[model samples]
Target: MPTQDTVQRLYDSMDFQRAVQCYLWAIPIVGMESARQTLIDNAGARSGDLVLVTGYRDVSVMMGSNVTTPYVFAHFDLTDRPLVFEYPKGATAGSLIDWWDRPLTDVGAPAPDKGEGAVFVLVGPGQKVPDDLPAGARVLRSRTQRALLFTRGLDPDPEKVRAVFETAKIYPVGQTPDGGRTRLLRFKAEGRLTSMEHPHGFAYWQRLASALKGESVEDRDRFFAAMLQPLGLEFGKSFEPDARQRKILEKAAVVGEATAKAGAFRKRVPDMRYRDDSHWEYLIPQSYSNEQDVPGGTMFEERTAFFYEITGTSAAVLSKEPGSGSAYLAAYYDKTGAAFDGGKTYRLRVPSGVPAKLFWSVTLYETDTRGLIQNEQQIVDRTSRQDLKKNADGSIDIVMGPKAPEGLEQNWIPTRPGKSWFTYFRLFGPLEPYFERSWSLPDIEPQTS
Candidate 1:
């Protein structure tokens, strides 16, 4: 017969293990929950409603976002009935992704409609498609109860971007566009509307519990769902953790975060390194599949690393051919392999002939929030589309530090002393050289002089 104390310790250990796994598995949904909760709470927007996050202040609040483009998106619930979404026929690119950060379909450039305007009939998991489908509408089958329609306006002119947004629409299948309760809801200013960082402590589990409410239990998730029961989380039931269970869950949350931070900041994977000579890493490899499905199983580690620091994924972002979608490279450290110190100064040299057919941009994000670095300057990015002075050959150097580097003010982005940061170098419409590795981007160097 086992002693009571020994049995209790064993049970506690098991519970902690399960809770840790829950945290890892729910990374994507937690990110999804943060975005959805923000729109509904801050903007008072509801399902099927399109909320446009425009301007620098608002767009900067989102994870892995840049102010160069206007973000147009909607959170749609298909539990009650099917919804119809219309993508405008203009300059834009992005995708409608499900809860797992899986793309339901590409919308703009790489989509079937190919920037030529398209209609979609979104059907929820196990929901029967109505017979009266629109003639030209494509059916989007979602495995989750809710889906997010995220896209970006790619025009250089602001008015043109607004025009593109005006043409977008979403409505329930049975309702006319006019009768639909959901419509475009644009806030003039982004007043700290949302923070994309996932909740912490017991709140993390709470958010996970809420996310699983309407979500159908997949075969893969059934085991994890069972594991959650002993730890006070279950579908169709309130998650009221007992004192011991709450302790275990709370402790697991801390460990989970540390584990995630370690894996993200310095991922151990071989392919994450963008180039052997550089410290820059690839955000998502060009070969990463939309669903992350591989030979034997899906790439959970890669998916976890991505959603832990960012949001949505799609085929358009994983551009295979040259001059198509986009390519993303990130740097968590400097040339000497040291984490970016906000207190220190650094410079990144953009060599001439960058292989982006459209444009390229460099932006900074706070290490913790993974959102734009908040500072006195308020500006978090510098791009080729802006007034960057390229060399006679199209090369430009960007400076980052606590203060503007004398004459380099126009090309400088302000950094805070105590807060560490990371950056992304994006090549939109990446060309053949980018794929062929003929063009190379160097690592950021700490400025000594």
Candidate 2:
């Protein structure tokens, strides 16, 4: 028989352990919830509305964002019926992802149409796919009704992008607008929107509850939904946290944020490391979605780490078909294993054999925001499309610092002196060399002079 004091101490210990477990588990759920909210808020996205983002000057922090390609965003609600999505013949690439950021299917150039353009009939869960589909139309099935349709206009010309966007259309299958005309809602600038910012305190739980309304959970994710029930976030129920519960959740959100941040900077999986001794790592590898083949079905830690680092999803990152996809590598630290400091200058050397079939680019992003770093020049990156001077050995030495190197303004990427930053090396239409590891990228070396 234990004394009253001993019993009280045991209870306290159990409570502390439970709090820690909840904190860690909440990180990934919060990340996914945040992304869903971001799409809804920034895109003004609603069921059955296709929002076309055509302006080149538009700025965003969403993952895999490229200034070179104009974007189109849409959220589909398939609870009532299936929707017909049609695209022009000139789109560069496109994807349809679920609320949890899993790729449903690829469209546009990566699809069977091969850039000639085609119509996609999106069918939601439990919905029967139409057998009598229109000629040349492809039927794609999604496990969830809430889906994100993202497309990129490949042309660099602003006028050409706008023209292509006009050709895209979304409408109900049998309820096409009068005269068979497709309606488009253009995206208007609504100032700088922070869609990825994590909601703090009780608001975090509230947001999750709101997002879960009428949303279907995958069988693999049912366990997560069960875990949230104890915290008053059960599906189809009111999420009203009491005073004490709110305090616990407040601390949990803070701890969860720190854990996610640490995981993003460090390699959580073996494939994430680019080289044994190098600081660079592959942002999205070919094996990223292969976790299910293993005994665990999926590696939760690796998935959390990825969503915490960036947003957006596409089969292009995982597909093996040539000219059908892209690749991304990120580096948070310098060669010396020190966090990148904006005050110091660094130079990255690209060897003679760059492995991109379409184009390659190195874009700088702020460490805190994970968005393109804002500088006086408004230029956040340099690409193969730019006229860059080559080294004697055919390599390119790109300089990055507060000030441009002498006579190298064209190759310099400016950074703010007081901020920390990182870079993403993007390979549009990655080729054989990138996969074979024959083409290697050097680490960012510090420049004291």
Candidate 3:
């Protein structure tokens, strides 16, 4: 026996709730759509084309990448035929992920192929995999035809990277031996941006629709498929949003971007924190799966956070074997628990007992864009591989601010005065000390001269 006004109010409340739910659900979809579009754009929308994306020079803010290792990227369409990926003996680490960002298999060193690489024959849904394969080749079956293959070089030396890059080959099965050679496309250091950002307005929905049409939907993703129905986004259908739908989607995109940003900076997972008082935290879990402490299950928030923070994945980030994979820790605040301000100088000291089997590095990034902070030096990071001056105690000091401290130019990472920034400390081939917490990193302390 409610009045008309009460009934109207109840309906409005339901509508508002639905809008909020839709916004949250769209976050991951937007992420997937952005990544898919990036791959497509880089590959020239052509399937089975490989692009060698990384330079001999150190990665800078130009590409928004901080990776020290040279990288290779490729887009694959396996609907009609299987694709073959051959790796060189010295290939380091990489992964093949589906359009939904679900990793199918690890490639190179961390994989069964090890450093002495092997051929990976990728077969998609309904594609016939040849029974007579090479003796040592591994078969990788993917649920979707649309896949991304990313591989990294072990050494950053220009000559070493070129040597490794020359060995990777991709081609459709049954193609001639000469046709199996991949087209090498080097990344341009100028004006390149690899990080995926949230799409503007209803274009996000358009990209989602295009991705859905290009890729197969998994059973686990059926729920999201159903959710998109209300917004007129369906597989194999045109995503022509109506006026009202466009408005809703536009608002939803804004909210989705905010949610992703919050999740990246203020993650709620307990295992993310490396130390109680420090801003540094483990960016990825030891397990490849997103489950916090468990073996399986999707940690949706954690996955979203990671995609928003960085691109690409590898078994190297998840392997349990010490010195086999790698580990990453990121910090946003100084020792006093204050957000890092580019106007103020800070110093981070790596103690003598740093734990890294291969090497370690600290790279700075703009807080908002997650890109390397632009500086006069054009360099984004300092690594153990570099011949750096060390203190008497065997420790190393890295200074950060607008200007270098006295004669510490070699150890300084410049930060723009008006912006905020963060740093990621990477342990390539991390050892037991890092996992067991026996080795600890000192907090970034503010330096007032």
In the range 157-253, model 3's lDDT, one tens digit per residue, is 6567667767777777776448645666554445555545555556666666666675656665667666666666777678886765566667776
**TM-score, prediction 1:** 0.96
Please identify model 1 stretches exceeding 4 Å from their true place.
Answer: 156-159, 188-192, 390-394
Compared with the true structure, all predictions reach lDDT values of: 0.84, 0.71, 0.70
TM-score per candidate, chains pooled:
0.96, 0.88, 0.88
For model 3 the local lDDT of residue 325 reads 80
Tell me, by TM-score, which candidate is best. Answer: 1
List clashing residue pairs in candidate 2. Answer: none
For TM-score, candidate 1 versus 3, the one ahead is 1
What does candidate 2's lDDT look like per residue over 147-201, in tens digits? 7776777877756766776777777777653435554555446676654645665
Weakest 10 consecutive residues of candidate 3 by summed lDDT:
55-64
Best by lDDT: 1
